[model samples]
Target: MPGSLARFRACFERSPRTVVLFVVIVIALYVGIRDIAGDAIIETLDSHYPANEPLRDILRTARNYHRHPVEPPYKDKFWEVGQRSRNLSRWLAELNGPWGSQLRGFEKERLGTAIETTATSLFPFLSPPPPKQGSKTPLRDLQRSFTKDSRGIVIPAGGSDLQIRFAGHLIASLREVFGCSLPIQIAYAGDSDLPKERRDALLSFDKTNNTEFLDVWTVFDDATLRLRRKGWAIKAFAALASRFEHVIVLDADAVFLQSPEVLFQQRAYVENGAYLFHDRLLWQHSFEDRHEWWKDQIKEPSPAMNKSLVWTEDYAEECDSGVVVLDKSRTEIFVGLLHIAWQNTWAVRDEVSYKITYGDKETWWLGLELAGSKYEFEEHYGSIVGWEKEGSPDDKAVCSFVIAHTDEKDKLLWYNGSLLKNKLVDPNGYEVPLYWMMDGKWEKGGKKDMSCMVGETRRRLTGEEISILQHSIEAALRVDEVIASMKES
Candidate 1:
């Protein structure tokens, strides 16, 4: 017995995994598991530990307390002693020992506390202590522990093959056209979202060989956050989950006029550690409920609340999340991400968030507000890009589908809605987009999915500006060719 105890102490010191097997074996045969399945246990540890093990499973199990469950064992009142009892039983079953019979006569309710304590001590990797409720420190610590010291572009791809095509354009623009060498991470929810073939196609976009793929499920345990299969929510989570300390989150269809690296050097981003752009300021009060909800949620108001269009102008939206930049090293930003994560969770979206805001756009700023974090939005409102209508009542009246945004200098920085002639109506005609409304008014009572411009002022692209647009269009066309090659071979 003394010899067994010594072996147990030694194995426990080496790894908690051994303690689990050692405890179970001791319970069953009153001896060491090292004597029965010693090599098997060692091999299991070798196969899984001190390497790139998929931590999602371990993390999910670790967080599986009675109060919070990855998957509830019973249909009713899941937050009870029964859950821990079930966890204890399931963990022991993996041992494939006679311990089940040993535990058969033990009172389940009485065993719950002991089982949890013993299991957590024996398998610390599989049973981490629950996070402190309503605290930013825990999330800050988690982010600090997980994040790496790097900067990169992160795009949440994978709803359909169409996203793959769009990502191809964006990646090509960054690498081939704008000449950005920053690393890129193509984040997807799971294997089903981005299959092996599509990932292989993305790998061909960057010749400098800095791009890689990240599974959102693998970034953090799904028990903590099971993202919706599709929607704007994925972008925020992708930005949060990325290994890069500083991340530029881009929509798959986003097109840039400049190398995005320049934004990192902006004074606002340098000061606040977060940067965002304004959505089209549609003058409508249709989102009173959302505003009220925000007021209730964010108790201690910050300067952002006073300056926001949501409160001041009664605008329905404030952020166009086509582009988002964040530095997770900031405790406020990391905590703000946690708030955004809760806001975008499957239940919250279906119940409140989506009904309140347009999509995931407003949640970004609102979440930051809720966490008392600071972020900077561009000084200019959203602008329009594309050609003027052939026959318009006003000479400068423009009817274009592209929603453009500007930099701090009020110059045309980038735009969403793609590079097609008319992304909504006709996609085949790739034209050199001209005419923009820097300070134009959004004509009210417009039809759905249309940007009707009413301002007499329009800014035509300079020769240099036209050249930049042309370069992005060519890069997109080149990506189309690559996709064609992929389909063929």
Candidate 2:
């Protein structure tokens, strides 16, 4: 032990830079390990180590603490290192040993601040590498093209004439009902997806022309990605192609009760840089293939996976992608988005993701989890908004295809079936349902595979909610009227 100490001392004396780096790593390890183990190990150490024990002994014991069962299974070694370094500043400032305790409060603060600066300075080297998607537009390249200061809404539309109509109502609700002035980008794969006339109609949604049309095929190389001219798979790729640093990707059929702009201020989105809504808790114990596929795909243990209902509750689905909020400037979110784009790319979507999950929905949260990106889902599961089946038992589910989501405050944030009773059945209809049902424990699938709310709980919208919905419906109707007029012209 003395000989080993002599060698270490000699090496440390000969190479001061190497010694400094070694100390930083050990201190960082202490900070990270302590956080996971919490006060238990600290208390244990305080009891076990005598006050007269050497500082080296205390550190060696602390280093051994990582072997405990509490170690976090973070796959990215760089991320683990960065996390360790980042926490060192606070740990050092709060250091309370004989020499450290002698430091004044201000002195400790200054020292902590310096450590923090050094830790952050190392971040460029420690940051997680962009995911290797092997796409035409790599995440690193796309990140370089990001408009860091811009924020906006992006809707992947122009898949069909019907989708164009749905997007019209969505834009109207955003501008007329919610009074949101954020620039709206209608993202399409090519001119074939959205013709000139359709582009003009979408642009007309906002009188000030705050809307712009994005041909994603032109923005991104389609040879490698093969973005379909029409499909739900285009959604994630559209978000990646968008120039905005902060983006809200809304489905063409999505209708909001409140301004989606408020989502930017949501505590979840503010902290995590990605906010997603939960899909209805359905298909439990079904889709074993999908469950197994996810298990095989996510080889690394993840905290996000632990929190997800897909794993914890064994639900087949979790995220509803109708309304997705993302801050692309964040490395984690950007990388996660890239993973989502890769998942939805032509080959992967057709061969794996689509076969496992119904559409592009499940891919959202799964990709984020796979990339270890921090994301928050709406606290509540989706609610059904439609007519309660007449003559059916009180406990029977509401017979509607609409899936509505609520915020932390339990207020209806948005619903995804559009204003019509059934958009596919009656495109021009403006009938909006009043009663929204929740706590749907049982879902009965129709021949068309549409899940009906057959649960035993129901809730009527408050007068304010109903009133706002009515105004939103009215805004949608006006958009319909304008589209009709444009067609006549």
Candidate 3:
């Protein structure tokens, strides 16, 4: 202990390289041991079994929500298989080194089981097996809804480049699937360069097909247009439309999973004035006391309804504009209300204006309330889900529309998967499904033969598709790394 500093200085000076090597060895040993221990813990957790009854109940409930008919007795088996497959897949993804080689086998077995279980459960829902003979009857029926003599318009608000591309993809998908010759009217609103590219893409498609592309700049005067944003412009156009039965003000990123004609059957519902929204599973807790802006407008509940003031008893439903389907009358009323609500207020962003003035969630609630309009709430299961990272459950059973919001790129995988599977109950035609790329193989069986469809259409990725996916994954990882590093820093 005597002269410890002097003694330590002497030892380091004599064996600096040896000391550095010793430190490296210790660090490596610690990391290796930690990795081993972590794997063991995860493995142990995976081995633990939950009681069967509760597990099956959860699976049965989820299945029921998607309109799938499942026998009560088989519910336990369904849950067990799903849980086991998910666990093994996750565990295998976590393993490292020589021991990790075993993961390949586990992943294949579990993934296959998961697919089989999901497919089997989904099969009955397919109704009459896919028509062996292609029926032009359905297509003809869809066409007659809107007179060939009549014209229709779809005004999508384009904000970002991704938004424009998404709108293009939706239009392309619709055209390919339906073979509908309806003259599509597209209006893109944004900065000169981005909108030009967007308009070009849409125009390119229109040139080959029969459609009209209207650039917002061409339609609007300099002063009037400058006062409004892209989203507002689209809404305004929808408000002004005269003869269109259904004026769809879709956010640029919302994609059409099924034929747009499914909406036409209910055309008269929204004809006079009806608001269509993707139904959100309202958690009473989430809306508790969250909306403050509407507090002054509505009577405050006893406990402030959890924390948001916007939660009013009048409307338990909330609408997301990502995909709004409304006829001309409803469009006129909503647009007029929105204009008056924001006229004198310091206009923040579109979503913000709604939130600040009426409490974001309550804007639609208030609009519907004031309009004295009865909304025909149609549940298009696929229309809206928060993005993957947004942690909305993969309610594939209920999803009819895949709304690509803040993150457009991730939704590409979902869209591709749906298209390739031909999952939509389209009266038109089926497109190829895309998720078979995950395992580089596919199997056939279960509902809709999604497995077979995925496998048959699966092809070795060309240099470009592989490159795009790889780049996307890497970019996402880099973003996560930056976020984590910032947190640590």
CA lDDT of each prediction against the hidden true structure: 0.67, 0.69, 0.37
Q: Model 2, residue 37: what's the lDDT?
A: 46
Worst 10 residues of 3 by lDDT: 381-390
TM-score of predicted structure 2: 0.70
Maximum-lDDT candidate: 2
After the best TM-score superposition of candidate 2, give how far the Cα of residue 464 lies from its true spot, in angstroms: 2.1
lDDT of 2 by residue, 164-209 (tens): 8889988887887778989999999778888898898888888767
Report the C-alpha displacement of residue 6, candidate 2, in angstroms.
48
- Tell me how far candidate 2 lies from the true structure as C-alpha RMSD in angstroms: 11.5
**Which candidate has the highest TM-score of all?**
1
Task: Report the error of model 1 at residue 201, Å.
Answer: 0.7
Q: Assess every candidate by TM-score.
A: 0.70, 0.70, 0.40
- Cα error, residue 35 of model 3, in Å, equals 80
Query: What's model 2's overall lDDT?
Result: 0.69
Flag regions of model 3 displaced more than 4 Å: 1-151, 190-197, 207-209, 215-245, 267-272, 287-292, 298-317, 329-365, 379-489
Model 1: per-residue Cα lDDT over 34-137, one tens digit each:
22343334334435552223222332343344224333221122112223333344443432245323443322222333344433322222221344333223
Deviation from native of the Cα of residue 155 in model 1, angstroms? 0.7
Error of 3 at 140 (Å): 37
How many pairs of residues collide in each model?
0, 2, 24
lDDT of 1: 0.67
Root-mean-square deviation of candidate 1: 13.7
